[model samples]
Target: MMKKIVPGILTVFFLLISLQKVQAWGFWAHQRINRIAVFTLPPEMLVLYKKNIEFLTEHAVDPDKRRYAVEGEAPRHYIDIDHYGENPFNVVPELWSDAVQKFTEDTLQAYGIVPWHISRSYSWLVSAFREGDVDAILKLSADIGHYIADGNVPLHTTENYNGQLTGQKGIHGLWESRLPEVFGEGYDYLVGKAQYLDDILDEAWSGVREAHYALDSVFNFEKILTEQIGSDQKYSFENRNGRLVKTFSKAFCTSYHDMLDGQVERRARISILRVGSVWYSAWIDAGQPNLKELIKKVKKGKKGAENKDEKIEEEKENNGHKLKIIDRESSDLLGMRDVHEMLFGECEGHGMGVGHGHGRPNKPHTQTAQGQKEGLWPLRMRDL
Candidate 1:
């Protein structure tokens, strides 16, 4: 009785752990992508991003979290482009308006809208930069980094995302989560500096097309490898976060990683470069504002709030220039609602289930109760 109960308990625990990790690119990868992208920024923008690096890194998973909290948030993380047909890129229009006209907004939303959402997020980031809203800029930067990372993920571009249809269930987590968490330390992330993108939408589609092109290898190699290594040797139990969890054996992971010929590393590097380029492009479009000045203004405002009696020091630091101090609390009020409303025009229904093919059942779409807008900012400056 004791033996049977222990095994059952362990099974439940492992399943829970696996479920938590099956999101797009996994939280660890997402944060790493965003953190590394910061280093790729030019000095002009680095001054601000460096100071708030932690905020950017930690908030990289905000969009994933919103899938469970905000209405219509899941679709922004992925696109099942394979649903469109053999030549999905050419079959589906690149522009959001054009695609909507061809497929209807409801039809497109039913599958996924990651590429279009990337463009929308990019525009919002440009707006945030132009407005010099530190909070919004940070928030949108982190959020856009996530969508861009997702766009580069091969799994995010397919309807069979998790391998459910092809009997390769759990492949999503194995490829995106387990492989990266295990071998990512050795990856060379010095992906050089970010360049400004002339056309954001074209860049976004380019990534999707490249990722989609690799889909056959992502699936075929795994299938071939699995046939070579029997189930007994394919998986093993290991301690993760202090608990024994069953996962793809290290040998199997190594085989698959080698079989892919550095595909995971390539995608991750691309994500970093693309994230930085998108950010730099947004800054350029925003009239090349001095990010260093934004940092100084934020610090001055924070200092003034802390020492109200030091009006003389504040004035002297201002150097006769009027400092347009942003109210920290008020500025921080911006959340996903603004982005959702900006792109989709409504934020009413709960989002679909975890769209990265985590094998979870679709979450029922229902109306969320009012007044639950807390924890929505992608980057919370207060914590910074």
Candidate 2:
């Protein structure tokens, strides 16, 4: 009885591990997207975003947490486009009302409403900005970024989200979670400034449409590589956070990444740009309230805001690697001094012309609720 029970327990443990792995974009990727999107905002919005950059970055994964803990949360993370028909783009209306009119709200919700949720999140953000509710603005901003990022992921747009349908049970995690974890650090993230979005709902739908189109390649490439490489070479066990766990081998990930030929990176970049633009647009629509004043008020009321230098200094002391944490205050001062002398330009109170620091330090700069080191930032915050 003991022997039989032990084997069953081991099987359940492995199964739970696999289920957990399939969560959205891995936690690190979601946080990285939110952190980078901050840099893309213009000075008006940047002033506001940079003040609460930590909040925005840290809370980016809240929606994922809520999916498990809150009712009606899972639908916001994905949409099974193929469920609608051959051309989901043509069949599905862009507007929320039109969509509900064509297909009842229950039907839409049953399928998933990620694209619509993106638009709803945008509106909520705009309201938060207009009201100047610092907490609401931060929470909604982080949440919207998550939905938009989810919309950008090809797997999130498919019915075979976890790939249980096509004998590719783990492909969802492999594509969105694993590929990015292994190869993402080296990809180019120099996405340009955020432009104002004219139609938020249309933009959301466009993202979903584009992601749906990429689904075939995401599935086919992995399946092809699996058949070629065989299982032994494709998987290996390694220590992660002090636990021995099985995962796709580096060689397998590299081969699959190569076969995709930059789809993952392309989608990530697009997601970053879209997230930034949508945030900026919401601020503008809300009459461009003074985020600076609000932040100042919040800071005064809340004691013990982490000192920027202390955090960086602590990181510098403990980090084993050579990578340095770019000093935000000094970097801004230097960037402004250079800009003023070179261009004879006046620097804004916010560091607009100043350059971005390199992406998050080599070591984790923050901790998760679980007390584990959260990952680094993906893009440098602009000096502005």
> How many residue pairs clash in each candidate at the backbone level?
0, 2
Tens digit per residue, CA lDDT, model 1, 1-384: 456545654665565455456654489999999999999988999888998999999889877766644557778888999999988888999989999999999999989999888888888888889888898899889989999999999999999999999999999999899999889999999999999999999999999999999999999999999999989999999885699978899999999999999999999999999999999999999999988888789889878886754323122233334333334454333432232232323322112232331344533322223212321223322211
Write down the TM-score of every candidate. Answer: 0.76, 0.72
Quote the positional error of residue 115 for candidate 2 in Å: 1.0
Identify the candidate with maximal TM-score: 1
> Worst 10-residue stretch by lDDT in candidate 2?
344-353
Model 2 regions lying over 4 Å from their true place: 1-25, 297-384
| Residue pairs of candidate 1 with colliding backbone atoms | none
Spell out the clash pairs found in candidate 2: 351-384, 352-384
lDDT of 2: 0.77
Cand. 2 TM to true fold? 0.72
